[model samples]
Target: MKNVYITRVSKFLPNKPVANDTMEDRLGEINGKTSKGRRIVLRQNKIKTRYYAIDEEGNITHNNAQLTKEAVEGLCDESFSKHDIELLSCGTGSPDQILPSHAAMVHGFLQNGNVEINSPSGACCSGMNALKYAYMAVKSNQVNNAVCTGSERASSWMQSSIFEDEVQHLKTIEENPILAFNKDFLRWMLSDGAGAFLLENEPKGTTPLKIEWMEGYSYAHEIEACMYAGGDKLENGFLKPWSEYNSDQWSKQSLFAIKQDVKLLGKNILSKGVESLKNALEKHNLNAQDIDYYLPHISSYYFKENLYDEMKDNDIEIPWDNWFMNLSEVGNVGAGSIYLMLEELVNSGQLKKGDKILLSVPESARFSYAIALLTVH
Candidate 1:
């Protein structure tokens, strides 16, 4: 099999950095509650900080396209010219335009007519999906060089009025009443950001990190597990005051809403992720002990806690300290989380050449995906 390696990785964050406490305070204000004397705590019991783009007026920017452009430029740098890029893929849930794809927009900004752009949207799994696709494309000799970028701007949807409306809507539902209980939790978990990565068939430097192998599996059983639908509601025999087109619902309902269902889904997803890792290791004639790092999607505190316990039960040794928990800082940037984590690891010197990295990502529909045996060298 051919080898595909990550040539360069770059990230662009907002100029203004908000600590967890600051974010908590902002949330408290939005909820009409006093934040004085309150201790803001993250699920991992770690300090979380995130960067948000700010305009000249010092307001947090919610422009996904601008952030993406910055990140891509940072990734390409002087080593790679626009003409050198053969293919480009953007893995994101957020896009600036409704008609043109985010990938195409990126291609246009890069102004490289030599590149073919494709966009893949897989919710939080989008980044890994793009990497997997790029790997396959290179291994198949379809593209000698490729780039996959994942970026998001989640602040656009974090509106108090909209959230209250969602809560009211959920309260009206009979079958899934428990979802209404974690309004605060849901609000706290979602955040904004963007990241990019440059991949190639040949290593540009002497450093030995290489894409060993990648496998993908998607489970469509619970397609609507996480959904966002917008529509006008009739209240008191009259439509609401909001504009007709603006009256839409953005929601996230998952099996994790219920304790029993959470455990089941957590167990199943973790087991599948482990199985995928084992399969990759077996194919490469490697073992769990051979892996040096594990990069799992920063889904939620609950999911991460359960996944850790499951790994311990299965006799899997996880480097919990180095697991790359960026969600606390960046919130959840959908598919960009994993790639951002990778960039973080590299920048922090936690990841080195010849180290094997295992990646696991779970989607909303009980779709647990995992990739194993990616060697840094």
Candidate 2:
């Protein structure tokens, strides 16, 4: 069987960079105990600026479908016609509509021939799931070529328009500042972006990157429903359906929120992630010492020490100097993070021929982890 290869990769950020203060200023204060000012949030998260699909006037310029289309179209190559793509896999945290899958919408926009379109939905891990599907398709000779995309329209969720009809909810937020802050902090930490990669059974060129291995693990039962959006978890721990809730209930429960037990997430994320990484390395009989780069898609620099210690505990000595991330510039872009990080690293002109890369993606919601091993040239 022919191995899967990523022929090309591309990323799209909707508009100009939006600073944390701009978001805070426009949204106003929701005074909470755990919540610091926007400046502090920016500092603690290490996100200086991130792109949103919003115009200068704070209006959303592109909807989810439009952004998804742009990402897929950007992945097009002059060497191959649209008809050549046999599969379209899209992963997203936010979607424009519930009826049609984001992948289907993207396919419609491209007017590309009818292809097997799959849209995998989740929090951050959704993108990796999409990639896994495409990888399997090509690796098994089910498709000659596939386009895998990860996109998010986070700006729409964070826009002030969402709160326009929730005066009482705003009052409640002000009354219970810490609880409100924790729920709303994700808006400041996240931005909008889309990334796409073309996967093929045959290498496109001499230097095409080869996908050596892929692995994913979940610890959903172990982690609380700390991060979520578009639904509510009742006292009984049953998540209420969106249609069952009224507008008022939606105001408080809708949108991205986090009841993060920082200690719990910090403690388990690295420990579990390292264990998964260990298994992947061992399964493939690959050595950590052979890795030329460690591409980690961590949400923030806050977890750096935790990751280091966890890897050390497992006897995986990947040096800190070998790791690369783009959270400071791009924030946590949900599903699109790993692709955007990889694109940035490639654009930096530091990677050379025959470089081995181990990419790690850890999602907060339900505590899932995904990793991929690849090699340049």
**TM-score for each of the candidates:** 0.77, 0.90
Residue-level lDDT tens digits of model 2 in 101-160: 888888888898778999998878899999999999999999888989888887667654
Error of 1 at 28 (Å): 8.7
lDDT of 1 by residue, 4-54 (tens): 888788887766666765664343333344333224325443436665454
Residue pairs in clash, model 1: 14-52, 208-377, 209-376, 209-377, 230-248, 230-249, 354-377
lDDT, each prediction: 0.61, 0.77
The parts of candidate 2 lying over 4 Å away from their true place are 25-37, 164-167, 170-179, 235-238, 252-263
lDDT: worst 10-residue window of model 2: 26-35
In model 2, residue pairs whose N, Cα or C atoms come closer than 3 Å (at least 3 residues apart or on different chains), thus clashing, are: 31-177, 32-177, 32-178, 33-178
The stretch of ten residues in a row with the least summed lDDT in candidate 1 is 252-261
